[model samples]
Target: MSVWLPTAPCTPRTCAGHTGPVRGRLPATALLLAGCSLVLAGVVCVPVVMLLGRAPRDRLIRWWAYGVVRAFGVRVRVTGRPQSPEGAAHTGTLVVANHVSWLDIPLVAAVLPGRMLAKSEIRRWPVVGPLAALGGTLFVERDRLRALPTTVRDIAGALRGGSRVVVFPEGSTWCGRGPGGRFRPAVFQAAIDTEAEVRPVRIAYRTARTDGQAAGAAAFVGDDPLAASLWRVVTAAGLTAEIGVLPPIPAGTLPGRRALARAAQTAVASDSANRSAESVHH
Candidate 1:
């Protein structure tokens, strides 16, 4: 599943002739420029969040994410909004979404206010790693079976303390060209233990232009290198991502973690399919 990830712009072979290819290797430059702005935003906002409070921090983080997405030339069109918890505090809620590309993080963060659960390996990625860590992302070491219980407990404690967390139960990214992988039920345990509300968010990518395809630009599928993916995104014109924040499924209504995960996955999957079909019809 791993490839050398050559830094070449996506060509006709991969993206058809609809998108521009900004010379091979130049993708890194575009990404670096985008990264710089985001890093600066992160630097400034992290402090504000630390010195201020949750509401201020969440607002700034949302603005920061919106600015970054815009700076990168990606237009985001948001659909439905998330349901705020009824009587529960903000931390007593969990947000789950479908995974498509690395951009998904910023895209979701742009609207949803919370820390995300990411793989532990992401902590080592250049530029992004530090920002994520400073942003208070919780790293999950999924490969270790023994660590699951402790990690779940930690997350439960954080939730009970009023931490709204985002999780991608898919475990892997789908190309956005097909149905994504299923959501894992394990993370739902945190929501269950804390009696948190679970919200479903669906992200779908499409072309800005009526005649183009944005899959190559936005999807981070198997073996797609970070450099190449950036090239595709920067070069592609009229790329739009639509985020649909669906209703929250009351955790109390679900039997347990498995039931919660199933309901969420079904809701997300159904929404995603409908969204894609709508895009095609329009």
Candidate 2:
């Protein structure tokens, strides 16, 4: 089914009796801020990466992602480390993760050294799309049958050339207010086709707080004004995002893409449930 998105206004709804008054930033401000940071970072790092070419470019890009996430006021809390086989850390591998929020991209990039497969529409976005492309993100157009072949081939080639690719198997962001849902299965096809090891990463988000109770919750969907939701998150004390990297599933173990995707979805779903349980108890 097509994911449902909310169409709420980005206005700052007054939360009765809140301590300090917080004003939502203008949508353009948020976008401008994020865009400026990305451009600034790129100006400095892109050159060095260019000099180093394909080899050290991955490391530079990952570092740049980390900086962008930090500058955007998003905090990433990582859990189980990605299990890389001996000498696998430096080679190309496929990193699969559950999608939780718009924040997931920067959060994942903050820690993992990899590229990402994004929707082709991102390429035309005001600032982010272009920046993403410059940073090695692969844009996929699901509707265009012809584009899939090239997308897969390019991704496979990147893996064989020793570049890790981060793909969101869920294909769409879950409702930001709750736990993660199931995966869509298509993202894992590249891992299966390329014979690349698949590493499952799960992302989780909880309300930000100080003493107790949610300081604020930011759920971006439907018509929820993107800028307003972002302001609530940015101004919140701190939001915690949990990232769990499960052990890699060997290439030949799964019979086909469907099987591989199902296995990964199951693994991520199981881990996410367990993680949620652990969070509730603590």
How far residue 119's Cα lies from its native spot in candidate 2, in Å, is: 1.5
lDDT by residue (130-245, candidate 1, tens digit) is 77787778887777766777767877877888888888888777665445676778888988888888889888777745343335567776667776676667666666777778
TM values, all candidates: 0.80, 0.73
Evaluate all candidate structures by whole-model CA lDDT and list the values in order: 0.71, 0.61
Error of 2 at 196 (Å): 0.7
Best by TM-score: 1
Query: What lDDT score is found at residue 230 in candidate 2?
Result: 61
lDDT of 2: 0.61
Residue 155 displacement in candidate 1 (angstroms): 1.8
Model 2 residue 246 lDDT score: 75
* For model 2, the run of ten residues with the poorest summed lDDT: 1-10
Model 1 ranges with Cα > 4 A deviation: 1-35, 43-45, 83-91, 124-131, 208-214, 272-282
- Please, what are the lDDT tens digits per residue for candidate 2 over residues 6-63? 2222223432112433335664357448745684767555435656765466567666
